[model samples]
Structure formats: C-alpha cells, structure tokens
Target: MVDALDGRYPRNWAESWDRVGLVLGEFEHAVARVLCVVDCVPETVDQALEVGADLIVAHHPLLLKPVSSIAPDTFKGRIVHRLIRAEVALFTAHTNADVANPGVSDALAARLGLTGLRPLAPAEGAAAGGGRGAGRIGELAEPLTLAELTALAAARLPATAGGVRAAGDPGRVIRTMAVCGGAGDSFLTEAARAGVDAYLCADLRHHPAGEHLANDGPALLDAAHWATERPWLDDVAAWLRAEFPVDVVVSDLDTDPWTVHTASAHKETHP
Candidate 1:
C-alpha cells in the first residue's frame, strides 16, 4: 500500500516543510480494508474503526511536528491510542498528492467542469511528461456572473457551516478560474498574473482578499477548506480499489471545524 501511494505521489514531490508518507502503523502488517479521508481527526478515526478499516489513507498527516509524547491524555494522543488499540495503520499523502497530475486543485476544477486546465503556479523541476503543479487555472464552458459562480460553487462543494463567500460585483462575469483545494491566499498574485476572471479556493483571509479585489485582481470565492478538498477523496479511493485488492471506503462525514452557522434574522418578521 505504501509503495502504491508513493509511486503515484512520491514523497520527493512534497514541499520541504511537509511531513508526508507514513504517520503510524507498520508497513509489514497485513491489510484488507482501507479508508480514505480528508482529515485524520478523532471522529474519522472512530469511523474507520466502526467500518473495520485496517489501514487509513488520509490526505492530512496525523503528526506534522515532533511530538514529545503519545500519552492518551492529549487530544492527538487519544487518536494515537485508539488507532494503536485497533491495530489500524495511518498514512498521509498531503502536498505530495497535491502536486500529482490529477491533483487536489485538479479535482476542484473538474467538479466545476473547467476545461483547458493548467497549473496556476507550476512547481520547479516538476516531473517529466507534464503532470505537476501548485494550483490549477482553467476556463468554464460558459461565462457566468459572480453570483452564479457562487451558487455553482455552493452546489458543487460539500455542504458546510462555512458556505461559499464571494468578493466582487454579483453581476461581474466569470469565465477563466483558478482553483486550489486548501488555503490558497498565497496564490492571489499568481491568479492575477494568469489573467483569470475569478479564483475559487479556501481559507481566504479578510485583508488579503480585500486588497486583491481593491487592486482589480480576479473575483474571489472562499469556500470551506474541507469542502474544497473532499472531492479528491473519490479519486484516491478509486485508485486504491484498482491498485489493491483491499476494499476502499471514502468517508463522507463533515469534519470542518465550524459546525453551527447563523445568519442575520429577517427584520420585518421579527419587528
């Protein structure tokens, strides 16, 4: 299983600061069922156990830093204990997976039916045969207003407490779009240079988004981080099913941190 994932998304492709590949469990252990998920939180760990998954192929690494201990008292510690008790292995495919051919952003673009797709910021010395990048930029089949694009994004992405938010005129036309599956504030300038009509991504901070719009950059669509990345799970699961005999399952549970949402109450009715 490790070899299969590394072959497709080599750890060498990951960024310097990223901790990809194996997180927990042993490669020598036998495996039958595998679960794919966007995050490796306590809830998802329980879900994997409930489903009888022996190996979990998570997109996010369980441990990014050098932890001092795995004592069960800690939050992440509890997750470690639970997985260890059940003898379930955890592996991550983070940024390495993002840099792959049909990457995280590629999946996002595909969901929106974007065509003529290419990397928004191509990686340095990316593998031969043209299949690596930081984010994706593409064109919609037909132009739509920013309002229409917001509606489309909400429809396409998984429902979340943080529904899609847009910056720009509701009536502004959107054709070419740049998409990144996770926090993409760093790509605003790249998207602008690409001359895309809009950029759809997650975790957009107020000041950066505001400044970009103020500078006449592309229209912005900030989606929930989890929602934007969830689509890639399908592709990952499909690949596992084809490459290995293990039964692969994709967890559909919402794991985004924000759970409750409240909008301004209708004034006329309240009054």
Candidate 2:
C-alpha cells in the first residue's frame, strides 16, 4: 500500500511547507478496511469507527500545524489518541495530490462534465518533468447562462445546505470552466488568463470574490469546500483498493463547518 502511494504520488510533488504522507500508525500494520475522507475530523473518525475501518486515507492532514503535545486534552489530540488506541492508521496526501495528474481538481472537473481539461496553474517543478499541477480549466459541452452553470454545479457536486452560490450576471453565457477543489482565491488571475467563462470552487470570501466579479473575471460559483473535495475521496479509495489487500470506504461526514438554516414566520389573525 505504501509503495502504491509512493508510486502514484511521489514525495517530491509535496510542497516544502506541507506534511504529506503518513501522519500516524505503523506502515506494516494489517489494514482490513480503510476509510477515505477529505478532512480527518471527529465526524469522519466516528464514521471510520462505525465502518470498522483500520486505516483512514484523507486529503487534508490532521496534523498540519505544529503541536507542542498530544495529551488528549484538546480536540485534535483526542482524535490522535483515539486512532492510536483503536489501531487505526491515518494518512494524508495534501499538495502532492494536488499536483498529480488526475488529481483532486481534475476529478472535480470531470464531475462537472468538463472536457479538454488542463491545469490552471501548472506547478514550477511539474512542468520540467512533464507533470501537471493544481486547479483545472476546461470547456463545457454546451454553453449555458451563469445561473444555469451554477445550478449545474450544485446538482453535479455533492449537495449541502450551502449548495452553490454565484457571483456574476445570471444571464451571462458560460463556455469555458475553471475549477479548484478547495479555497482558490489565489488562482483568479490564472483562470482569467486561461479565458475561462466560469470558475467553480469553495471558500470564496466576500472581498476577494467581489473583487474578482467586479473586475470582469470568470463567472464564479462558490460551493462548500468539503463538498468540492469529497468527490476525490472515491478516486483515492479506488487506487488504494486496486493496489493493496485492504478495503476502502468513503466517509459521508459533512465537515464543511457551516450550518445552514432558514427561518419561518407565523400568520396574524387580524381582519
């Protein structure tokens, strides 16, 4: 399993600041059932336990930041302890997975039915060695209005309370599409240069999104960060299942950190 991971995702692809690869547990441990998730949160951990998962393959690392201690006193610390106690291995593929061919962003573009897809911003090292990078730009099968494109994205990607939000003229026609799995504010200029008519991703803040829209950039469609990355879990699981003697399960945890609700009002009985 480790060999497969290393083969498909070379360590050199990882960024200098990233903590990719295995973050917990022994490499040779017997993994019966594995769970694939975007984020290694409490809900995902519970799902792994419920499914009797022996290992978890996640996109985002649980230990991205420095930790002074792991005493189980804090939330992340407690999760680490629980995994160790249960003998569940935790592995993550962050920026490395982002740069791989058919990576998270590519998978997302495929889900949206985009074609002729290519990396939005090809990584520096990747180009020299014939490798792709994070984010993807592609063409839609048929052109649609900005609002229609937003609706299509909401329906295609996993549905959540924060299904989809757009930041362009609803009547504007959309042909080319650019996408990044998670927060993609940095790639706005790249998408514009690629001449994409629409850009879909997650975690688009007020000012940045507003600025891009006002600048006549690509029509933007913001979705739940978790929802956008969740689709790649299946791709990762499929690769692991084909290469190892382990079972892989996709976690259905909504770890977007957003709680959506609508309010209602009562009617008055006055004439």
Candidate 3:
C-alpha cells in the first residue's frame, strides 16, 4: 500500500516543510481494506475501524506539526493510540498529491465541470506534471456570472457551516478560472498572473483577499478548506479501487471545524 501511494504521489513531490508518507504501523503488513479521508482525527479513525479498514490513506498528516509525545493524554495522541491498538496503519499524501496531474485541484475543477485543464503554476518533478503544479487553470464549458459561479461552488462542494462566498461583481462574467483545493491565498498572485476570469479556492484571509481585489485581480470564490479538499477523497478512492484489489471507502463526514453558522441580522455595506 505504501509502495502504491509512494509511486503515485512520490514523497519528493512534497514541500520541504511537509511530513508525508507512513506515519504509523508496519510497512510489511497486508492491507485489504483502505479508507480515504481528508483528516485523520478521532471521528474518522472510528469510521475506519467501523468499515474494517486495515490502512488509512489520509490527505492531512496526523503528525504534521511538532509533537513531544504520543502519551494518549492529548487528542491527537489518543487517536494515534486508537489506530495502533486496532492495527490500522496511517499514511499521508499532502502537497505531493496536490501537484499531481489528477490532483486535488483536478477534482475540484471537475466539480465545476471545468475543461481544458492545466497547471496554474507548473512545477518540475515526478509527481508534479506533464504541466501539473500548485493549482489548476481551466475554462467553464459556458460562461457564468460571478453570482452563478458562487452558487455553483456552493451546490457542488460538500455542505459546510460557511458556504461559498465570492469577491467580485455579482453580474461579472467568468469564463476561465483557476482552482486550488485547500488554503490557496498563497497562490493569489499566481492566479492573478494566470489571467483567469475567476479564482475558486479556500481559506482566503481578510488582508490578502482585500489586497488582491484592490489590485484588480480575478474574481474569487472561497469555500471551506475541508469542503474544497473533500472532492479529492472520492477521486483517490476510485483510483485505489482501480489500481489495487483492496476495497476502498471514502468517508463523507464533514470534518470542517466550524459547526455552526449564524448570519448577521444587520447588513454592512462594503465598497
């Protein structure tokens, strides 16, 4: 299983700061059932066990950040302990999966029914492309207004507390667009340079988004980080099922942290 993951999304494709690949369990152990998920939290761990998954292929690394101990007192620690006790191995494919050809952004673009796909920022490497990289650049089959695009994003992406929001004129036409599956404010400038009609992505911060708009960049469609990345789970699961004999299951759990969304009664005008 590790070999399959490594071959598809080579570890070298990940960013230097990232921690990808096997996080726990023996590599030699046989993996019959696999669960593909966006996060490896306790909830998903329970789902993995319920589905009898011998291994979990997660997008976000459970131990991405620094950790002093796995004592089981902490939440992440407890999850680690739970998986280990169940003999379920954990593997992560983060940025490596992002930059692949049919990568995170590829699945996202597909949600919009985008065509003529290519990389927004092409990188040179094994997992990267025949033109794949940071984000995806493509065109809609037909043009839609900014409002229509926002509505499309909301309808297509997994429902989240914070649904799709857009920054641009509602009636503005969007033909070509760029999409990144996760926190993509980092690629704002790249999206601008790509000259797409809109940029659909997640986790756009206040300052950067405002600044990009101020500079007359493309229209923006911001969805929940998890919602944006969740589409990739289905894509990976289908691939795993096709490539291996194992039964692949995708968890449809909404793991986005924001549980409740209350709209403000008073409307504030923004120029």
Question: How do the residues 157-199 of candidate 3 rate in per-residue lDDT, one tens digit apiece?
Answer: 9999999999989999999999999999999999999899899
Candidate 1 lands at a TM-score of 0.95
Ranking by lDDT: 3, 1, 2
Better model by TM-score, 1 or 2? 1
The model with the greatest lDDT is 3
Clashes of each: 0, 0, 0
Write model 1 residue lDDT over 223-248, tens digit each, in one string.
Answer: 99999999999998888888888899
TM-score of structure candidate 2? 0.93
Distance from true location, Cα of 199 in model 2, Å: 0.6
Candidate 2 C-alpha lDDT tens digits along 1-271? 6667767777788888888888888989888899999999888888988999988888998888898998888989999999999889988888888888878998898888999878898878733345488798889999999999888898999878888989988999998989999988889889888888999888888998888878888889999998889888888988887877778888877888887855448767897
lDDT of each: 0.90, 0.86, 0.92
lDDT at 10, model 2: 73
Relative to the unseen true structure, what is the C-alpha lDDT of residue 180 in candidate 2, on a scale of 0 to 100? 96
- The ten-residue window of minimal lDDT in model 3 covers 123-132
